[model samples]
Target: MRERAVQRQDRLLSLVRRRGSARVTDLADQLGVSPVTVRRDVEALTGRGLLDRVHGSVSWPRRRDRPGGGRGPDAEDLVLGLLAPSATYYFADVIRGAHEAAAPAGARLVLRICDYRPAEDPARAAGLLAAGAEGLLVAPGWRGPGDQAAYSDWIAELPVPVVLLERSVPPGGPLAGLDRVCSDHTHGVLLALRHLTGQGHAAPLLVARADSPTALAVREGYAAALRALGVRGPRPVIGSVPADRDPEGFERAVQELRSAVSSGAATAALVHNDVDAIRMVQRLAELGVRVPRDLALVAYDDEVAALADTPLTAVAPPKREVGRQAARLLLERLRERAEGAGGGGTDRGMGGGAGVVPAAGAGSVPDADPAAEPAPRRHVTLLPTLRVRASCGAGAGTGGGATG
Candidate 1:
């Protein structure tokens, strides 16, 4: 119900802005709502001074007298685009977070998902820029190895501020020139490894997608945590999931887990994400291996781990928080660029797209500053929480989970 109200309000705002002024009856008819509902919404916006309410008609505040007054930037004039690699599973939550953030942060949001294909993002970003998007929030570098240079380089060259969500340049990617927000995946993996060790599983295998930037960090964290736990000898098997999510590769990933288990390569294992973890769990069941009895499992990015039959213990990333932070960061950058208030730095690293639409009132802002000190770039790392449940056998005597 709250979501419905918010959507209605957004629609109302868009309509008023488009038409300059609208009658309450027309608004109600257009919005498929009652005149009373339109009046109430108009009343709310009028209180905020966003709408000039006269009798049954509504209109946006005039220039020099809008919400931000004469000089302040207005959010209504700006459009920020978001490009995500995946539309489902893990990335879906990030998009949800960004969507929830749009109204509060004050920018109009344009969202596009490329189905995990990084090759297509440049074109999408180009299109959004041409369509008048002023800034961008993107999840890039998730394709295969050869994509880093092209993907990161393209991001480096954009004409507007870019905030990366769930991604930052790893090695061979573009060097730092943008803001980043992502989970502290290394620490997340370390936590899972420590929990596995606590459960008496010393030689747990770590299964991960080798091509993933987040997975790479997790693998590093797993090793670092192992060192912390005083296990310095040969490390556990670091099994790699292939780059493709294609049917053949998907089957191969399941087969890889089965081989690892059957060959005794893993007494206990930490899988990188819930999707593969669920697949591994289901396969283990078919192989007659009951979870925690014969094998202990810990999954990362706990999006759907709990939905599995055994309800696996998994490390849950602060996914929504990452997106929220990224949105906030992007908005701040846009504001700074518009106001020329902060020391400015033009985007570096190579390609150019479209210019930002000029600002007015609160939405009025400048291009990049030429003389001021550059604003500090931000990188927020949020930690993941482990949700303990049945798969890790959480109970006194059966204690293999960290419920405390």
Candidate 2:
């Protein structure tokens, strides 16, 4: 059953790469299999990062080369596990980067949506881990104490290494030992603030979620930058608006902002993210206010914000680099495990075993071989850069332009 599944997956990948797109019915007919079988194959391959399905059409990832045409690893079932907080565009981009990094190492990437639930079953994630997942990548959802503890315990007990994305565990905590690849939110906010400052804006409002770490970091950075620039006045009227709440709630929040603006509490705003920023823009327009002329705006996460109608100016993080770093760490752990299983040379510096070397000679000889030494594990914290566009005071073709 496993071998047949593998063969079908390989053939499906070949078809997807050759044709650029494949339909389930066409794939089933070409492969001499039932439509149900083809659907399963497509689902499995999609989970494994071999293909992307959109509106009933399946296509190979644009960044990846055709199957059997590259020296990198094939898109195998190497996915150990995944944790998705929400199906937001930011999370999707992060997942895409992870898949790109893992696919080259013959690893599959399985996504599990947490959906802002209070708690998640560790056992639910265990099955994938047991099925040869070398590591786990977690994007935690709306967290409560119980949920946080449950996730921390799961990470502690899991045999494989783990990487946390866009979130942080408690400081001086055991879970902190695990690898982390996250956007530098402090720097991200600094970039946004600096852009606003350069545009001759002062006392710009900062809209944020009250208790979110991402929000807190952004607030801290904004405050610090303001203090450094010798600016002050009512602390920019910070608000705790829940973007994840109901659609009406967001509308209500915007109404409140409009009221505040009418009362002269704020002039310009720096939103926590593009979603909220764009929503705010739309709401202001509906309220008969002009953007940039009446109010300047900036946001975080460039991809989603840039796609907005006004093409938002935002701080962009090294998203793909974060994914690549996390995958590379997990792959190192996997290679260590493979070396241990095969009883190969233990000179890889993982410190898993005592190797076979003459006792006296072992003491006399240097253990570090330039070629045999493991590559240094990298802990990368990437700062965000400002992508100035038409959304802010800078018009299109201004000195500051969209970042790659």
Candidate 3:
């Protein structure tokens, strides 16, 4: 606790030094703390003569002999652009994580909601750049890998540094050179399958959607996990959505699950996304099928999965952490760019946003090779863990961690 408080104070000092002066309310907001906490820290710094109180604001005690007399040139005042499909849903946590990291480092986030409009992403990003976005964190609205891969060319040609958030291109594809951070849905699938199979359930069926990139990844991962685990039987993949979106499709999924269970073709199932899984459970209940009695189930995306009547076991992706790491990576990219361009006042000495290391994930470039200079292009992939619950017939902590 003491260490964290000290670190926070150091960041507080850095921000004031970089900007020359900052309001107390703005400091609290930027630090992601309360006004009282900021006031306390300010008082402590003022006692040491490191800061000067000026009305409702604070300033560095030292004076400047010339203009631009701060720590480094353009160290503060970074405008980072973020483009996501939606502000709600999963991206909300991602945006919050990015904002939390950006604010403390004196960077402002400019968000652009594209609402799955892939064709409009470039235009929106270009507009952000025109409005003085020095760096970008973009989660392109891609329905699938192919859809995102198609837009790689334009993304690569953007003048400013770009870091992909929750999105990536194929290996050796157009955007391979770009930095990206995303959840390892493949590992997420592996977690769900291994958990079900660990309890002696073989060849669990998969009911998923193909409408989003995450859904597609889960579908593909299910196939690979089955082959890897050598669990053989009638493994079928059913496509589905919420009941209201497509009643016929939803009915087909429920019927498929019912048939599989009744015929003893499968005794367990893994469903992608919480909504579909929850709805499937509800419809199956109407048919007199009880979860964990006749069919053990696990759902992907822990969001609201636990709210079901059966309290679904789920594979939880690190959504918010993906945003934090992506933002931190973009800040580093900006610093590197500034330094390479001979910006003497660059924030080279300042610790990049939040001082947190990126979590390792799939396709991640290893950092063990000290001789590798200039840092290889990163594809940081965060793994997902399985949350055990009643639906999967698991007792407390029966599921495995991400490493498992």
Candidate 4:
């Protein structure tokens, strides 16, 4: 029965390729089966990457030239584009999430690193789309008004959906309608602050890249915690480090912190993200500063920080979950398109062809809508609990020296 069903689906697809569209009733009559059977066949075939059903109609899948000069079916072949600035452990995890999502759906994932040049993104996006990418996952290197405009334009022109990971865009931007998934930095920061304060430390320094939304949120969370404790003298000294120029940039940050410590400005320091946090700890150690005694430290993104010598007390986000969600959403969109083509009575069995329209669904897929505004005074902040490791004093409950 399964073999016969497969044969029937193949025949229907062949007809769709030739006729450009196939009606469900026509397909049922020709196959000598009920329309219900045809529909089920079409759905199964669609899931298998053989056909696309659109708005009560079916059409043959489009064919595109393969890179090696042979023609290939477009329905089963898809390009999933990924954009990032530089290769880091953090970005790598995000990419892994996206790939895990795309693999089961029979889509190919392509990666292009922008190297911090936001200007180059649009051209890269266009080239990928031209190569037949069905969707995109972008991790913008930096944020600015002009960069936002370019990203918006690129998204508007793409033939499929674009999912932004770990970055926020401007309000009323072109990509505003699209989906986004980001770490709940505000809540993560609060958790870090509470951990430090609970350790009986006050006047900790908050270090980050200046003016970034994530940095700002961390600073705000720290300030709120400080205020709640009624500790007032001078504000927690917030400093910015550059993500583009590392080593030297980090060295400069170390010097600044040394100066702060000398002047009695800050005792403990909270590094913005894990990357910087790890670097900060290393640099401080090189300068003969002991962690948790001379300067207690906490960082964000526990995954990356765990790789450090101290195994940092950092915030962990639902990273793999984010990737799985995005992948599921894109697959849903593809499936919807398939169903629409099948029901239309057009060519249900063939790949891409004329008379097939893409289908859009409400943001029902997991993490499909990243920009859905949070409720008033309430944010969907993923909590980052203290990992209680050797890096912070919580490990052995000792207020002095590093733990083993």
Top candidate when judged by TM-score against the true structure: 3
lDDT of each: 0.69, 0.64, 0.76, 0.60
Model 3, span 89-125: residue lDDT tens: 7788999999888888878687878788888788777
1-404: candidate 4 lDDT, tens digit per residue = 34455346656765765576788889889878889989998887667545578976766555433345332213456657677765565666767888887877667676767766777776566544533455677666555435555544545445555566666555444544445666666566666666666677775677776544455556656667566556563554556575456667667778888777767777767787888887778777888776766777887666677788877877666666666666555555445434442113322111222112234533122443434322111111233455656566754553432211
lDDT of 2 at 321: 73
How do all the candidates rank in terms of TM-score, highest first? 3, 1, 2, 4
Per-residue lDDT value at 220 in model 2 = 68
Query: In model 1, what is the error at residue 315, expressed in angstroms?
Result: 0.9
How badly does each model clash, as a count of residue pairs? 13, 3, 2, 29
Tell me each candidate's TM-score: 0.70, 0.67, 0.73, 0.63
Q: How accurate is candidate 3 locally (lDDT)?
A: 0.76
Worst 10 residues of 2 by lDDT: 347-356
Considering every candidate listed, which one attains the maximal lDDT? 3
Model 1: residues >4 Å from true position, as ranges? 1-73, 170-174, 232-265, 343-371, 395-404
TM-score of 3: 0.73
Point out where model 3 deviates above 4 Å: 1-74, 341-373, 396-403
Comparing 1 and 2 on lDDT, the stronger one: 1
